[model samples]
Target: MGEPLTIHLPDPESAIHLAGPGEENLKLLSKQTGASLVLRGQDLLVSGPEGAVNLCRRLIEALAYLWGQGRSVTSVDILTARHALDTNRTEEFQALQQDVLARTRKGEVIRAKTFRQRQYVQAVRNHDLTFCIGPAGTGKTFLAAVLAVQALQANQYERLILTRPAVEAGERLGFLPGDLQQKVDPYLRPLYDALHELMDPEKIPALMERGVIEVAPLAYMRGRTLSNAFIILDEAQNTTPPQMKMVLTRLGFKSRMVVTGDVTQTDLPEHQASGLSVAQKILHGVEGIAFCQLGRADVVRHPLVQRIVTAYEGHE
Candidate 1:
């Protein structure tokens, strides 16, 4: 609506080859900044409002710098540039950044205000395997499910596999009625809810039937190799150490795994090591493995939920 904004880059013969797919980068930047961007020669033409235009220019410069430095520029970087261009104070933008990071293709960004949600997303994008440890309401399971949905939508993986331990938090699963899925459905419902948000409910059953999406008990993962899949292990604290080893070993080439759990909420009996906890200790310093510990400050739920988590922490 305002004056057109243009950005000119000096022709550096040495950096010309560094452009490497400039059109794609321009498209990505335009999407993030909500500004139409076109490149002619060494000039970038962005026509938008004064503020948005200037912001786009800054973002383009930043992207060129990052690319020139050989740093990977991900979607996160695009969002970060948008945040920096829009806001003067970083604290508010940081909160917004967390929301942007919590975004998934299946649904909108997480509404809850928690930094842990952002860290969880970052871990998933940056690592081959991510361990998200936190208390309830931290959006651990929900965020993981969202990432799985995004991976599927982007065709980054062939399928989505969601697994959780069958162990009841306190009750007995035997007391529940019906078959195995019926018995475990209560535990797996959260995952289904996430999927429904990202995809049409009608499509879910078809995908499940076709094995494009699978919801199963952790025990069923034994003796199988999972390749080209976005695998998520939820409520991992209920798994025993041997079970954890078996599950981790099942990762086939080109598969990414995310394990989410609350260490403080472990239901495992005393003297038995929780697989999540054990993995945290054993996998530390291991290359290609990432760990993200979410604290009470990262809880992105009702205000009361944060207070409740803090009260529990006080008792500990």
Candidate 2:
């Protein structure tokens, strides 16, 4: 333990702006530094161990610099600052950061360009199971898939399984297809696209054949237990409570699972309840599990996509 320390900002104007625009980043800093921060007019009061307080001060200063430049502070910026503080503290911290960063930046790794994506990665690393809830185009599925792939490549997991409910999104799968794979291929194309981006297209087939990677409909996972695997259940909002329970209970030793969905995009008809919505309530406060609620601001697609999502949300 160390002594408490406080920092005073330049003035109230800057303080107001930091508390407004930089509030989220500041909260993240508080978590990272294990400090309690309270703003009193122009002064930022931080109470914690001396080292942690000093690190928090440096983080606030860095944020002030960005805010002064008209740049918005992000979660990634806070994480980077935390990494810097750790590196400055000890060589062991630098080594750990290098190892984590290396794994995070693999050959086909999709860099997190938004705050939500960065938080998603952090949540996955910190928790055994994570639920990423958001609207479409928020990179929920893609990022989860990439993390699964990285786990597979690094030998962290023996296999990767990508599963999703085969609920028809206004299209009749039975009317349009050759066989089951061809029928569900449309639903799973997004998963395939993610794989193609992260791995050689030609090699993917061989990997699939070897069972190192498996992408299948949620129905196929009913009875089996999954162990030593990285499992992703996308479009989970379409799953029924029974289905969600079944899927979750299937986790065996050394397995990690990520369930992602958009509550607004549920395709289970108007009468049925969304499993994701239910799971959020049921799983709250459960240890070793994480939940991330992403908003329209987290969308990393075309700039207009974010606006469109915001527009729809505003109308609702």
Per-residue alpha-carbon lDDT of candidate 2 for residues 4-90, written as tens digits (9 for 90 to 100): 665676766666656655476557678888887887777777887887888787767655554454434455445555555555633
Tens digits of per-residue lDDT, candidate 1, 106-224, equal 44444333334565677798887899898887778887887788789889999899999878834366688888778888888888988877778999989999999999888789889
Model 2 whole-model lDDT (C-alpha atoms)? 0.77
Which lDDT value does model 1 have at 33? 69
Top lDDT prediction, candidate number: 2
Candidate 2 lowest-lDDT run of ten? 96-105
Model 1 TM-score, 2 decimals: 0.67
lDDT of 1: 0.75
